[model samples]
Target: MNLVLIAMIAAMLIPMYEAWKDDNIWQKMLALASISSKAGIMTLFISVLRDDWMIGVVGAIILTVGNAGLMLLAHVIKRLDDL
Candidate 1:
């Protein structure tokens, strides 16, 4: 595993732990957690594809934020389901 990957996973620790403790919408939590995982993977992907560090960094940021936003969307959907 890459060091960046390790760091990314470590970053998710708090969110994952908190989400697991949250009984409501556990699936939603898991989906959110997966966003971090995907972000790391996407970063690795872009890094290997491009020699440009700036592009990789920017793309990774965008992808990661988009992933988390999807998770937030899921949360909203779950809450709406409750209504």
Candidate 2:
């Protein structure tokens, strides 16, 4: 379980590095979305390991809603870029 959590944390860092290295807006947004997803998954995993329903619920919400908000923000940025 510890190894799995460590691996997940390492995986999350990849996107963070990409986001930091890239100057393009689209790439940055994609990287951020990836980070959000990984975070949610990590949270879910932690909740399951501890057998906690409240944390699980929060994880589920993050998994479902975080990306949607990011997508909406991306769309808004895209429109603004077009202006």
Instruction: Give lDDT tens digits, candidate 2, residues 3-69.
Output: 9999999998898798788787888888889988999999989999999989989989988999999
Each candidate structure's TM-score, on Cα atoms with residue i matched to residue i, is: 0.43, 0.92
What lDDT score goes with residue 78 in model 1?
88
Error of 2 at 67 (Å): 0.2
Error of 1 at 29 (Å): 4.3
In model 1, the worst 10-residue window by lDDT is 26-35
**Cα RMSD for predicted model 2:** 1.0
Instruction: Give lDDT per model, in order.
Output: 0.67, 0.90
RMSD of 1: 5.3
Per-model C-alpha RMSD: 5.3, 1.0
